[model samples]
Target: MRELLYQINEHLKTVTFIIIRDNNDKSEAISDYNIITLKFDDIIKSVEELKLDFQRYEDSASKLAELIPRAEKPFKNEVDELKSLSIYNSNLFAHYYSNTLCNNAFNERKIVNNSIFHLITFRSIVNKSKSNIYSLVNCIKDTLFANWSFKNQGEDNPLCIEFNKPIRYYRIGNRNEEYIVADAALFNFFFDFKKALNKEQDEDIINCSSDDNDSDGSYTSYDVSRESSYENNHCKQIECQTFLFIPRKRKKRAKNDPCKDPVKTIQCYFRSKTHKLHIQFPNNNEPEQELKKSKKKFYKKIKNKVEEYKIEKQSTICPEMKKLLDEIENDINKEFENIKYKYENMN
Candidate 1:
């Protein structure tokens, strides 16, 4: 029995040593540093001796059971503690090794979030959907590299790879300017990543693919050109300029809110100024008349307020107050001019 126990102890100790050495080697390779060294042989021998001692106690208890018939409570506690200690040691080793590798990868610029690679996926999907794929591709490349200053970190980490599955986008309505809806799983993934990266919700990110078409024979597509310059950034910029297309049953308009008003209803359907032309207005003369009326009303209100203030002050307004008001008016005009300049040079 003694010889059998001794041999078992020796084998267990050898196996434990091998496991410790392998773990250390793996840690070193990943971190590129030899920071941890364990005398596994010595540690394993001590653990084996404890195991052998416990086995002897178990054998003694079995023999004692025939005579006394009571549980070995003390040995059970010791064995539980030994198992817990082993787990604690393993956890400590893992924590130290993982944290080191994580820190090193961060320093080397290799541990970026998964969203960076998704931008590439965005580009690929857009390129596949477009008739002029090369032009779209070039435009995206220019925006990503030149405009937003994006840089790539190689695939040393798993986060650098594309998603495990392709995300699907569906068009919501028959309108050409409709927003696309993404699959639930894809939406969750995008939502989580955007939240983590502090990126704004982009219409392009959920763009409709040409593959999905609504019953009215229209598909939703993305237009990167329509994205605001202020909102376009390295992390949020997407290349997919085409809209998504989804199918749905025709919706019935309420009696009070009839769909006959294409001018008003179309405003809610499309996003851009160009698409607004699709909705036929009641008459061209109405718009001109409305503009003239609005301008006249604005000037009339301003003049009435100024006249009221002058009457209250008995036409003796302070010179400093007048100068201050003039300066404020000048500043407002200057700001308007600056805004005009910016808009003029936007193209």
Candidate 2:
């Protein structure tokens, strides 16, 4: 599970770099917008295919579980693998779909001009984590649902339950504004369940070792408790340290003040959470880290190119264009209100 989490995290980092660089480059951004539209369509079709696959697997597991009697030990490994795979595919679908939404929102002229892009950027991060949690929870629910057939005597039917719903809305900084975010409830549940599962497995191992007939291996409860406690404590520390910094209006700063002169205002508006695990578990020989560093450099170049384009565009503005720009700005303000209205309705 940890490895899977790491893989998803790494994927998100790559996706972030791609998105930031692509959005920052005028020509590239246009090209990417086109490509993403096509890719998103394909991804939607792929999601349909995955849903079918999940349904088929669920049916097969249900049948198998029903055939296995209550007294008989079922093939746990096969069933578990199927459940996990279904979850992984579901998560992949969610991630790709969310990414498509993000790309579309970012590319939308109205959305970008209205400054809704800021909220979309934050939501993208939340979605990245939430998708994984949703996937795991759905998988567990499906597995348990299938197991229900085996538990009921002479029952050929399986009962399935809906997975826990995702969480949304998180307070940004110390502000009253609540940012629409993905829920982490599923992930928290999975974390606790995993810990309990590990504890049970450890007890089974100890019992096996102490038994005269069994000779599997020996593992002390002390060792298990120490490792589990360490992990729990580490996670707690990370959560305590994690914070989102949202920039609020300074004492004398006006609500309509533009963040043009000092970039500090822009910096203050953005927030990021610090993860101590990354520093503690640094990979000294990671080729991946080098690749990431290179990606960052490339993104920096792209950003510069975009800034140059913006300057050129500004300089080329004639009287007619200035009037048009003013009209567009007015339209943007109205459109922003509409977007906010829609968002509020969603809430």
Candidate 3:
């Protein structure tokens, strides 16, 4: 509770630039009053007296707002200045009261009560409907969207979670049975897709496949950068290296890597059951393919490539490759120790 009050007080300091007139009609900054530390004693007592619910929070928020004195004239009669001031105030409120910037705020606690209200309210509505299950799910989606919108009111890039497309609800069971059914894929959509863009230091593979939408596992990577819209907002295309291999179960690769070979010439796979690391190289290629290099040469090539890329630590070129290499080398050293013991025992 002390921390919350401290946070509120800290935030209040920034918005205390509101100009107000004193008893002598002399203009002075609101900061001169030293009202930065917001005392919530009265509000807390009021809330303690009332029932703990959405109505209580609503009343509390209104009272809290009343505590912050509004300047009759924050700026001169210039329209642009007024507009800019309004934006600044809105941003401050949005950052603290709304989830536009983050979810940690006093209003977020209020939203919890709102969510409970929505759930109970929708439960009654769903009970009256003929299709209970489907109606309940639809209500849940509606509640989530309502909360999402309420929290992100003043956000510039508000991310929305919804079905990829409208689901075609069909009647399930016999005609006499009143039950609506939709594909299970609808529920899977929320988790399988991501709307957030990857940052530069992000270690995740960039998936850049333009074509091949229906994941049959024949993956390929290409240098394609484009802009596309989702929910009417323009989003840059995913540039992660493994964006093409979404449906394929594969290990992570370096980001923005120059190598785009479909077939991995050198790869490491962990054999948990055997306690071993399987290092496959170009020499292990089947179908009697032409040998690019001997095993020693291939090992040298891999070593040189790792050194050339400076894959000793996490960097922009390959953030996660160093950790992966370390794990592989650790296992390899363990196996070498076992081999050396066996050789010594035989001698």
| Residue 28, model 3, lDDT | 28
Model 3 CA deviation exceeding 4 Å by range: 1-104, 111-347
TM-score of each: 0.14, 0.19, 0.16
Ranking by lDDT: 2, 1, 3
Clashing pairs in 3: 205-241, 206-240, 206-241, 206-242, 206-243, 207-240, 207-243
Candidate 1 worst ten-residue window by lDDT: 1-10
lDDT of 2 by residue, 262-306 (tens): 122222121100112123223321322222233333334434544
TM-score order of candidates, top first: 2, 3, 1
Better of 2 and 3 by TM-score: 2
Candidate number achieving the greatest lDDT relative to the actual structure: 2
lDDT of 2 at 286: 30
Q: Candidate 2: deviation at residue 178, Å? A: 6.6
lDDT tens readout by residue for model 1, 1-347: 00000001221222111121243353232132322323434433333333222222223222322222123455344333333443334442222222322222222222122223666574443333332322322332232123110112122321111112222222325532211222212222232233222223222333333443343422122212333324643223343222212332222233433123222222222112211221223222232222223333333433554566568764424454355344434443444345334544643
Model 2 TM: 0.19
Best candidate (score: TM-score)? 2
TM for candidate 3 is 0.16
1-347 per-residue lDDT for model 3 (tens digits):
01011112222221121212233422222234522332334322222222111122222233323222222232111222222333234232211221211112223333333444576564443233323323433343333223211222332332333332222222334532111111222232212211111112242334444454453323222232333444244332342111112222223443534232111223321122122211222122221111211223434544565665556542423444545455544654455445445544645
